[model samples]
Target: MAKAFASQGDMADKKISFTEVGRDLWAFTAEGDPNTGVIIGDDSVMIVDAQATPRLANMVVEKVRSVTDKPIKHVVLTHYHAVRVLGASAYAASEIIMSDKARAMVVERGQEDWDSEFERFPRLFQGHESIPGLTWPTQTFAGRMTVYLGTRRVDLMHLGRAHTAGDIVAHVPDANVMFTGDIVEYHSACYCGDGHFGDWGGTLNAIKAFDVDAIAPGRGDALVGKALVGEAIENTRDFVDSTYRPAKRIAARGGSLKETWDAVRADCDPKFASYAIYEHCLPFNVARAYDEARGIDTPRIWTAERDKAMWNALQA
Candidate 1:
């Protein structure tokens, strides 16, 4: 029998953990689901990547309350995916931050993404109806912006496009902790549905330039030390390479999408088969890789209609 479309069959709930990754940096992780990063400064708090819905984000809020009462002054968007940004209202933050490129993507396809992702992963959108609306970035930067909460500094930089064209990483130079949104996933499968495989590799290199002691990734466990951080970075790179390399070869040889998918699955499954979201993301990952390998520089927007059509074709 064919597999269930995307994550429709994934109904199991995951336990959430909040870990202090650095001096004042905290990571809120859910097994292998999307993760959120927290930074507490002397006077205020900043949250990276809000959860999918206000109700779900309330869990992160409760965790933040357990640590500090410094208001959640800012919420940052690593990219403009619904699961990442729709919960911005829960914080009532004074500023919602994202790259200008990210804001443009929201204007272009935010609604489509909202519908497409909600349909694919209903478990993640537990309180979808509670979301006020699309989260808008109050502040957008072209390349880099430094936000200071009293003496603490949070550097938001768009190194390059990886998971999405608007991806950004937050660096705390003093504490040496970096919140690398979806740009660097630890053990979790890198969802490449809207990714730029070639550019993502380069972006990972740029992330390596930072002298980070700890990193809170988009998914999986937090990297608490430099050694672990290095391993996580390489692991993420390995995943991308293992998936895209084979898919690219197949695509370049004029092979069909199924052939590309089969080639990548055969090569990467042994290594990443147990990773979080591996099964859910493989079809989309292979689809994007196949397109990029064939000279499609920009990722096509994934609509609800497109998602179903693609899933049906690929699953069969």
Candidate 2:
């Protein structure tokens, strides 16, 4: 029997947990769903990644209300994914920041991505209509940008391309905590649909070098101690390598896409079965890994049509 494509059958509501990873850094993690990071400064607050819809973002806002009434002045997008960026409008923030490359990616395929993702994960897009067309970044930086929320300094750096061409990480030097967007996910499948495998490995090494005590990764639970943080980083790197290596090997040998997909599943599913989105991400992850291994440096744009074609071809 053939299985449903993507997350079409994943309708169960996940348990969400909000924990503080640093002095004022909070992580809103929904089981294996996308996690949102909150950085509260003396006078204001900054949200690392917005939820999927305005209605969903409202839940995050309510959580913020529970903690403090500090105005959410900034919404930082870790990358240009619809699930992460579409909720920017809900925050009513003064500044919505993202990397320059991310802004370009939005301009290039925001609409396609919006449609493609909404179809892929219906549960995440609970209030899909609440998303106003596309979310654009009001401010964008090339490599690094620093913004001070009252005396607390938040450093946003684009170490290198990993999950996307413009993935960004938020570091709080004072607290020794970092908010690594989708660049690093703990106990969750790394969706490499639009990722750079080789570059992603290097980026993880860069993040591992940080002298941080805790971390709020893009997904999974917050890492409280240095040991747990290191473990998450190592596991994430291994996940990326495990998936890409098999697919790359198959591609190098002129194997079919189905062969590459089978190879990846056989190699990684056993190790990552308990991880979130493991099955949902496997097909796209293998496709991108195959393309990259075949010398395609830049990731191809994913559209609704292409998504379905690939899914049917691989999963059917």
lDDT of 1 by residue, 1-316 (tens): 9888888998998999999998888999999889999999999999999989988889999999999988889999999999899988998846999999999999999999999999889999997888888989999999999999999999999999999999999999998999998888877899999999998888999998886899999999999988999999999999999988998789877999989988998988899999888988887898999999999998998988989888887764
Candidate 2, after superposition: displacement of residue 108 in Å? Answer: 0.9
- Overall lDDT per candidate, in order of appearance: 0.91, 0.91
Reference-based lDDT, residue 207, model 1: 90
In model 1, which regions exceed 4 Å deviation?
none
Q: Please provide TM-scores, in order, for all candidate models, with all chains considered together.
A: 0.98, 0.98
The residue ranges of model 2 lying beyond 4 angstroms of the native Cα positions read none
For every candidate in turn, the CA RMSD to the true structure comes to: 1.0, 1.0
